[model samples]
Target chain A: MRATYMFGAGDVRVIDVPDPVIERPTDAIVRIVRACVCGSDLHPYHGLPATAEGIPMGHEFVGVVEETGRDVATLKKGDLVIAPFAWSDGTCDFCREGLHTSCRHGGFWGRNGIGGGQAEAVRVPLADGTLVKVPVGEDSALLASLLTLSDVYGTGYHAAVKAGVNERTTVTVIGDGAVGLMAVLSAKQLGAERIILMGRHQARTDLGREFGATDVVAERGEAGIAAVRELTGGDGTHTVLEAVGHMPAYRQAIGVVRPGGVISRVGVPQYEEAPIGFGSLFGPNVTLTGGPAPVRAYIEPLLPRVLDGSVNPGRVFDREVGLEQTPEAYKAMDAREALKVLVRP
Target chain B: MRATYMFGAGDVRVIDVPDPVIERPTDAIVRIVRACVCGSDLHPYHGLPATAEGIPMGHEFVGVVEETGRDVATLKKGDLVIAPFAWSDGTCDFCREGLHTSCRHGGFWGRNGIGGGQAEAVRVPLADGTLVKVPVGEDSALLASLLTLSDVYGTGYHAAVKAGVNERTTVTVIGDGAVGLMAVLSAKQLGAERIILMGRHQARTDLGREFGATDVVAERGEAGIAAVRELTGGDGTHTVLEAVGHMPAYRQAIGVVRPGGVISRVGVPQYEEAPIGFGSLFGPNVTLTGGPAPVRAYIEPLLPRVLDGSVNPGRVFDREVGLEQTPEAYKAMDAREALKVLVRP
Candidate 1:
């Protein structure tokens, strides 16, 4: 089977890889129908160092179940399924509470020993717990939306929900990436009265406005905070969705949120050490919550919305490519030429 | 009038000071009935650079209203009251949401130009908003309990509540100081099924057990994490209450918390930065929420419990001293000779 691999920094290639087979009693074999180049995937594509000689490279995919292990009770062969970013044993305490990222037996795809999801076929461990059956038929137009459930959209939704964004809330989304754009949509869907999208790119900000951003702040850092404050009449917004994991983005989120408001962060936090001291954040008593999205937990509830087409998060995908074009897709996204790139197997 | 003053690090003395009078239309002169040294007070007592030639100290006090400005509509000249650790205008949006600590016009005691609560007499700004009327007449046995409302108990309760401690939760209280001990009591009051207190001191741990800590981990750092994990069947607690603001304490709070769980921190955070990258905490998706307690917001709801004697959080007080002996009381607490010191003015 052919799979995408990052040989080194700025080096991505589609290479032939051995087929994945069920290695555990709880495993299932999935034939990938659609996959995408995730923002996180850019980590290695930038300079995280090659984790493996020929690492399989993706964690988000919608596929058909080709086979299931004997212990897989809830799923069967031929089922259309969406795999969350990580695989978890359904019964762990954290997983039970919808926090699958911390599952005791859970692990990430394309990392450690697991095969990546961006392939012709992949083996999914803890299959019953990680795979969500998409009841609808294989509708290609809906593939982008379904694939987002595996990570980005679910993550953005988690950010909005965790921040307690509601009909009365005014939210500021920091970062204009697909996840940030999606967060604007989620905040709107969650009934935020006003959404502020902070980004430098007019094209992205335009899409963000379409996604429900009432205003756009094109500045970064201190300037970004001033912009948000000005937009909010100097009181700042009630909620901040941090979809950019850099230090400046985090600081801006903290700076622009109103007193007692929350900063829900879902950006793949790229920075180390967040200074939360008495002078900066504790005095005003801000609530900080958000880690990885519990995609498995959000899928069922968000599925109906995706199916009904009330939210077509697929709009974030500006470019599409075939399996053979995966390497070029990575470059296009890395160069900021594509909002998000979807790939067909 | 006499008030406690911090002349330098490790120096606390009761010094003669001019008597306070109503300074604002919303001000009320409070003749302090009781005051106490808070754990945070020890911060300055230890090494926080002294502020002035005569800096007034303390932020936890219960007092009788000596006089009220005409604009102080809610407080009377003779009403007994407990002033929250901070003062705020009741009309601010943050104050209305019960986040008085973040009120636009709010300010903490003993800082800026405002007088500290731990004084013979204090001119409480925004008296109507900061002072919670304790309807009943003075009861000596309840003095300690009422004093706790000014800061310690309220802060502890805030920790438990922020962490979502409830009947179904298993909580771990880090730091067995007055606030941490109070958190144990608060967790019990909030209905946590199993409460774990992490402290190395047997004397403090004994008090913690008395305050409803079901288990005590006499370890620090990794050993502490292991102890908590072992106690919770290797899964860790669902709610971790962090009452110690030091770095190790913060790390332990993050380490022992269950995935998807919350770390409610009310300790005066002293650290400069917290590493929250995908490697450390983001992947596990822990929720960090807490700060200085919004004591004003909690006082009204917690007052009845203190009055009815259903909860006696005041047991955290272990020594009593006169206002003139405030310096000795500070040393006693700093030397770990007292859990808390109640001062009679």
Candidate 2:
């Protein structure tokens, strides 16, 4: 089987590797139909501690079950499914509360735990809880959208929801990447009246507008906040999604929200200690919430939308490559040549 | 009229000042029966920014309405009232949404707009929305407890409520000041089973126990968290009320809450920036909320309890002094000789 591995910073490769087999009773072996690189993957590719050592490179995927272990009850061979980024037991107190990411036995599919999806086949732990049936006989185009359900789309939605995006909200998303673009779609779906996309590139900015961004600000820092304020009648956006996890972006998200507004930060903060201005937050009374995407809770509802064609989040896939081209796909994504790179395994 | 003013750092003087008159059409002039020095006063006493100049001090008070402006409809002369630290018009969208502190026309009483409450007479702007009638004829002792309802007591309740304290919760309060001590009482009222008070002084800790702290932790940093963890069977507290706004206290509050727990921070953050580990918050799913106490909302319910002896938050005041002795009161509070200083003007 061909699989992707992070050799080091800026060193992603696709090479011949052994196929994953069921090592645990609750595991399932799935032949991945589609998968993609996540924004989080860049953390390791850029060489963060967790990804310093070469590790499996992908988590989001839709696939057909090739085999299942004895304890796997609901999943069987040839079942089409969407596996969330996190694998859980599905019955823990945390999982029951729909916080599967915090499940007691939960593990991220790729970097830290077992096999990931950017391969021909991979081992999935807690099959019953981790994999959701994608309704048999879904189209290949639908597969890409369902593939997104495995991570970014769900994460974007989670960020928006945490920030309390509603019909009356004016939201400014602080990134024009795939997740940020997906956030625009989610905010629109959730009835955000105005959506602002912050990005540097013209192409991605236009794509954001197409996906529901009511405006775009090419500037960064104080200038960006001024632009956002101008768009929001100088009161700032009611909700701002911080999808780019860095100091400047985080500050922008906090700065561009009105008094008593919320900043839903979905960008995985790479820094161990980000300086937060307590005075600003306390004075303006802003609410900050966001983490990893709770994909399991979202996959079910989102699947129906994808099946019915109400949402077209798959349009984010600007580049499609074969599994053998996984290394090139990572490069393209890293160099910002592609909004999203989908791989056919 | 007599008033307390901070001529500069370490200089508090009780001086003869002109009596406050109804300056605004919506204003009311009140004879302050009782007023107290607040933790925020220390910010100016220590000479921070705009407050470095000589300024009237105090934001918490219980008083009798001596006069009302032509536009005041809520109260007449001789009515006892609890005045919130913030004055709002209550006509703005922020006020309608119950965020009176963030009202467009809202202003802080002592430091910004209105004169300080630690004076014989206070000119309360937007009196109709700022002052709550103290159940007509409440006793002076009850009024003292009600006086705290103007600030710390209500702030503590706000912290507990924002932290989501309820019947089954185990709560940790991170400051032993008046507000922190009141938080212990508030937690009990909210039905929290195990209230842990974090303080260093024996007397304050003893007072905390009396105010419903089930346990006390005198340790400061990691040791404090370890003690709290041991108390909760290694899960940490369900809710953490950060009544001290300093960085260490803020970190302690964040460190001691369990996964999915809430941290309600109400203490005025004197510093501009503090380190925020987004990864820590995101991985654990902690909810952080708080700011200025929504005194208006809680004052109504709390007024009855204080009057009827159902609550005795006034016990947090360890010393009573005349307005002329407020400088010594500030020194005592700063030196930890007093938990709270009640001043009679």
Which candidate number maximizes lDDT? 1
User: What CAPRI class is candidate 2?
Assistant: medium
DockQ of each: 0.72, 0.55
> Each model's C-alpha lDDT?
0.87, 0.84
Model 1 DockQ, alpha carbons vs. true complex: 0.72
- Backbone clashes in model 2: 0
RMSD of each: 1.7, 2.5
Worst 10-residue lDDT window, candidate 1 chain A: A43-52
The best candidate by TM-score is: 1
Residue-level lDDT tens digits of model 2 in A110-214? 645587788888999999988998675545558878788888889899888888899988899999888898899899989997999999888888988988999
Candidate 1 ranges beyond 4 A from true positions: A50-52, A73-76, A136-139, B50-52
Error of 1 at A186 (Å): 1.2
lDDT of 1 at B289: 82
User: Candidate 2: where is the Cα deviation over 4 Å?
Assistant: A48-53, A200-211, B46-53
Superposing every Cα of model 2 onto the true structure, what RMSD results?
A: 2.5
